[model samples]
Target: MNRRFPFDIARQEFGRASRGNVAVIFALAALPLLVGVGVAIDYAKSANVRTHLQSTLDAAVLAGARESSPSAQIAKAQSFFDAQRPEQFSAKTSASFSVADHVLNGTAQAEVPTSIMAMFGRETLDVSAKAAAASSSGGKVCILLVDQSRSQTLLANSGAKLIAPDCEIHVRTNVSPGAIINAGVNLDVKRTCVKASTVINNGGSVGNLEKSCDAISDPYAGKMPSVSIPGASCKSENYNPDVSTVVLPAGNYCNVNFSNQTSVTLNPGMYGGMNFNQARTVKLNPGLYIVKGGNWNVNSGMTFTGTGVTIYYADNSIIQFNGNVNVQLSAPTSGSYDDILFYEAPGLSQSNWVINGTSSSTLRGLIYLPSKAVTINSVSNVSADKATMVFASLILNNTNWTITPGNKAMASSSGGAVRLLY
Candidate 1:
């Protein structure tokens, strides 16, 4: 059976069918495009927040590791994180700090808020950072200057040559060019670490120079013994002996003056002021010599020798060696002041310690003056074979000075350093 329809009626039916198919195809394609755009925007927001979180955490951990106190470290970490966090996102920051066996460890964590990613049900991003620091325990330090002010805390000039091959020199000056070697001066050492704002080298050679180093704290600050002046002087007035050889016993003296061709031998004891002027020979026995509220002066031609001894200076005291002199000193091998040749009292007035001589000198111990400046000028040969440590506020070398390391074991066993771990 053949059933025919009108042309207008068939055209209308085809047009309606095509319109429905076109609508369905357009709806299917538009959905995926919208989804892709939304995902990209949400992921970009997450990535931005994650980057900020990681940077803040890293800074927080570093701050925490620098603090020596355990309680303070945690507090510092939190504060640093809060300060470094970006204001665009709300982040919950937390950190932990711990120290064991001189090693400091820090960990920081942050939960950063997400913005456009909320559509995907991801509302937060986790970021973390860790840091570690250590206080070094081994290594010999030949020189340490602990002054925070002063552009030239350590200076070598006038053709001075300092050779320290087995140790490091640490300078803690906050001024520009904290340590310098002037023209015609040569400094040869294993390492020179400075905490100065700037470093300057004029015409000298230094091996392994490190600028902006960490400050070194005193290791024996609290361990020094207290000293009290005697109520009544055991011996008073000046002692100018006419004889060639004289032996002085240990006691409390008001003022000790030796001059004019006198050969003096000092027994182990306390002295108020020991002054030697134009003396031929001076000897010190094995013990401690405490000088209080006076000046220890050795001028002109003098020969000095002391073995197994330690010299302690009280407040407002000065030690000077002028003119040509021969000195050989060694610290005690055992006791409280073991391996300590010279020690200055804490909280004393800031002054200058001068050591100048024309002849060779041998010192085998530590010379510690935490609050004073030490100047060494025009010495021929200075040898510290049994380990020697010079710790002062400032150290200046003028003219020629030669330093040789004889023994590394003479350095203090308690000596160590603190540093941040990157």
Candidate 2:
């Protein structure tokens, strides 16, 4: 030790001291950076837990809102929440619900624990969410499809436009290859929903789509007028339309054809479905017109008009109306089938029903075809005071339909919508 010089000893001591100071300075600087990183990681984990709770809370709120009683609602909400609890962060959650003014309101809170932020004394983060829902009326399904297993239940072909400001367009086929809202078709309505999970919108302006919805059952099923076909003795014989005017009584008939510019009037009763090839003018008075087995077709050269009428297709073959002239029709009010214009029998053959009319047509009321593929073609628009079309399937080809909802019964409600507040 005594062999070393005094300058050498001093240099060795300075080097050791400098190294110790540098390490101290580095530890001090890295502490803040480590804490910042830990906060970010823990905050992201808490946010992910909150997101999971939010989606689960939405489902719980909807389940509670659909219940009838307050106790039942709470039970349903609790059951659904338990069944669909998010398995994120082992969170502790609590939910509460209340119904006021026909609206179901829900609030939920979660204690989502942080992982890395625990070192900085942040043990848990508080998260909250809210939701509201209500029920709608039963008579608001306007353009509805009944099949729930078909590949393609409804299609809006090229050049098809539908503007229904207050109507409900519900397609209920839940199978794959579902409804196609193709290109060149414009659909603007109040509410448009498809039950299928595979709804394709190809460059067309369809509804703000909410797919995979619950299928809606037909409202008018098992609820229609009783059918009683008239006997041959009480039936009207063959109608020969070589005259200028003919007033038809309420009776049954078979294979009647109207031609030769004949003017006709119809009273309400059972009758065989007929064809209108060429007619000057045809009027249907106010009552129920039961149509038995036969076809109801109107060619291009027919001028037909009806108001305050209900045509019940008991067992008709087909209903195709080609419109080149004036064709006006409506449904009855203050009756059993108040808003029903054409009611196809549920037991009828699964055929096709084509309904097209002129732009001056006043075709209104509910056209219920539960066992038929309904088509609307060659028409420009369907402006009506009140109309509801329920089909097995629907097709629109090169036409436009302006479905106006003048009936308060056909108006939409807030039940179909569930909203999250915060």
lDDT of 2 by residue, 1-422 (tens): 56889999999999999999999999999999988888888778778877888788788877765553344556777788788877687888887777654455777788888867777688998888777655543224567788776877888888989877656687878786568878898888766778888888788788656678654556567766665656654443444555667788876666676665478888887666577767778889988887776777777766778888988887746656777756688887766777678887667767788777555566787777788887877776457556777778988887767776534222232344544433
In candidate 2, what residue range of length 10 has the lowest lDDT sum? 406-415
lDDT of 1 at 194: 83
TM-score of 1: 0.62
- TM-score of candidate 2 on Cα atoms, chains taken together: 0.63
> Which tens-of-lDDT digit does each residue in 90-134 have in candidate 1?
667666666543345766666766555566687877766666654
